[model samples]
Target: MKAMTFKAFAVVNEIDLNKIAIHCGIPKKFTWEEPLILKGAILESILGREINAGQMVLIFSFGSVVFINQTEPSETTILLKFIQRFEPDVEINNADRYTDDYKLHIHENESLELADEYVMVPEFEEFYPELISTVLAKSVALEKTEEQLGKIHDRLETMIDRLEKGKLRIGNKELARTTAKILRHEYNTLAYIMILDKPEITWSSSTASEFYDKMMEFFELSDRYKILKSKTEILYNIMDGFSTISHSIRGLFVEWVIVLLILFEIVLTLLQIAGLLP
Candidate 1:
């Protein structure tokens, strides 16, 4: 009847793992396969709390943190502050967040199964925490990206409404800003977060792979990512259409000015020949 609470936050765009490792005096090479684990004395010191038993903090390079068994809000807040030293841009009060409670029953006569946020296992495994934390961190990161795309979608919708009213009032500066925002979002999702990629451990351990797959499906990560991509393409097309229309309008205005200038020149020549103007 042992249980733990996992709270994950997507706080920043990216974390400089190398800098944090060096400052923390960690010698081992930090990689995407694993997160920086903090527990025991280090965790207590960072938290400034005496009772941090069974509590663990997992910091991923992709700007998410999973606090295992650290259910207290104050504890979570304090640890985030500590992380801010390494990642100054980390957003502490992010809107996209995740929390789940899991019950682990070990040494039981039941089969190993994870269902409805409960785990029944014959024996406790060491990699359980890592596996769980990885999924939680990734899920939270996707949640943050989803929120960003949602905002972009709303902005596009507003533009569409204006277009419906025959109001294409976007200037060059506004167009450039919108294009840059969309491209930056795509790049961040692909480069820093790499949300579509699975954890490296999954390639080696079949059990880990299966668990990761199930968790990903539960979170609808793949489907949501595809939707985001589709929305991005639609945005691109809309911008292209806007640019084309603007160019056409400018060209038509130039043609009309050229015609008017020619007509004025002909009228002046007629007046001069008839001795009506110099």
Candidate 2:
């Protein structure tokens, strides 16, 4: 009998769950006797267990239900070609985005994809070589954009600093940061998973809503700060210009006084020469 197996993983780096299963990574050598493959979340919840790092879970079944399907007609065919372009550490092993019901097995190898680092795009006009400073702000809306990213940076720094340094673990799907960070690239919007020290892998979509909501509020506050700062800068620039103009005018008046004094002395000398006035 040909049985298909699906492999997946999650991290309990900081989850506050009771470890239902002990250090045994995989339950069985193969799970084919029951012929029923249960969902990972359900299995996890039912068992009241937390999956740790470097753990493997194997789910076996007769056929397979796969997610992460290729959108294009030839996506499957070209998958290999595309995969070759990226490093194994950067590869994503999935048939689709998400699945609740499926037959699957999971191995907790240090897959390059799980612990991969994502890059942050900075929003600065000076950084853009093609655009001048004056036009860059208008084109990129830099103040608005920077405020958004600035809030993210600030929030992350604050969370990391305020919270005890540890891994984030989860028992419920409701606190998943799956949508905000993984799919959406909104890293600062991850929900509160119990924090513990461990190699963390957060792939749950459970915290997306909460994360997004928090981030939206953060963005609004940042926008307001940016507006206030812009106005302050403008006011300061105007004051500086006024001071410079005042100094220049003062110097011009002094020069005019000196010229008039020279003219007056010349007139006195001419009057003395003509003997018409004292």
Candidate 3:
């Protein structure tokens, strides 16, 4: 028997899910309310040809459109090519699995474990799409954070150079302001990924929830999530340090100005008392 291959693709940054539902001719019975999950029928081409080797499930969410194919590698390529024709604007990222080498034992809860590399499920739901989208979103967010961090590092270096030259500069305040803006942007990005992009699965089905939790472990989604969270915290700490340094410098400059003004006043009074001026 040929092994089953599972392939998932994140086809877009955001999709008008209503448009997808109408385009796919989704049935009322197959739609979910909370997170707006829709499942389409087995997709066929214009010539009435099946899109993939076995079956294709079309899933749509707010920021992601996923096509799960149960097929071989060659057929998978054909399926992706067909999708790209209609979705020219999407940015695609994929996760793949091949289940040939392992002994498969079908469980009652619609999930089958094939060794350590692959897991098979009878149906695709909100969990699968959410998992795939979270992975892609985290990757994109991580890249953005790294890029911002590089800019922050460069600015810190420039500030250190000016200080070494004994120049009391206010540019650090501007740098702090810019860093605050970047920090807000990064915070929003991470928040959207963590909170808004969550999967809203109904808890009415214990089996479904169990399967999802198990699959999450199998995919190591928690590990990736933790890593991203840690990086965001580090970025926050650096920005906080910059803010502290900026305030400290500003305070010292103000104190020096006050001292210089007092000294000037004392000198003027001494000069007048000594009759050195008219």
Candidate 4:
């Protein structure tokens, strides 16, 4: 029997976990343990297949849903359609296929070279969704961060143009405030992806760790992680610059107020000396 695995992922903002469980028709007892991983048997009919071929649905709190099936890649189409039935507002969708071979003696990296071929293992099936989900979540996070950066760049460009023309007004300050808020939200999203949403190492299982490490390398996850880190740092620097500029503007306004007060006092003293004021 030729075993094959197909994985599909969808990026969403937030999925009500309980709602999804209920929507999938998972029994309340089975869901109480780990609501994230839903077995295929419970959804087989709804998914329109005998998931005994191997199926698992993993939902991440970071807003990613991964469906893994050990059947033909074509079979996944129905599953994907079924998921979309519940979640109509998916932001991004991606799919990957791998053929499983038991006879082939393939190293982890070599398996990647085959591209869509993988060595069959029970542990791999258990952990595969986490790997795929991590990658998908990271991709989504990067996309979101880049979008925020783009908006900040646009606003910054406008602010720079106004400043160059010596027409920086109260609106500029408001823009800076808005940008800061966006930056904060973006930073939080990045943190969630990098820290909270990452896949944890299964210390007890060295095989699982090796698989994760190899797969991460195969996916160039480290490189992507570095890029995300660099982008986050750039955003932090920009936010810092905004803060400095805001403080400088406030200082300038304070100085003008102080000078005006001083001039008013001098005028009042002169009027009193001239017997023109009480």
Q: Per-prediction TM-score, please?
A: 0.85, 0.23, 0.56, 0.66
Model 3 lDDT, full chain set: 0.49
Better of 2 and 3 by lDDT: 3
260 Cα displacement, candidate 1 (Å): 3.4
Better model by lDDT: candidate 1 vs candidate 2: 1
In candidate 3, what are the lDDT values of residues 206-247, reduced to their tens digit?
665676566556555566556655766775676566567667
Model 4 TM-score on a 0 to 1 scale? 0.66
Clashes of each: 0, 21, 0, 0
Q: What would the per-residue lDDT of candidate 4 be over residues 29-52, giving only the tens digit for each residue?
A: 322112266675666665666666
lDDT of 2 by residue, 204-234 (tens): 3333333323332433434543554464444
| Per-candidate RMSD, Å | 2.8, 24.6, 7.1, 5.9
Q: Give lDDT tens digits, candidate 1, residues 20-95.
A: 7777677878876568888887777778877556888888987888888865778877888888998888777752
Tell me how many residue pairs clash in candidate 3: 0
When 1 and 2 are scored with TM-score, the better candidate is 1
Candidate 2 vs. true structure, TM-score: 0.23
- Per-residue error for 33 in candidate 4, Å, reads 14
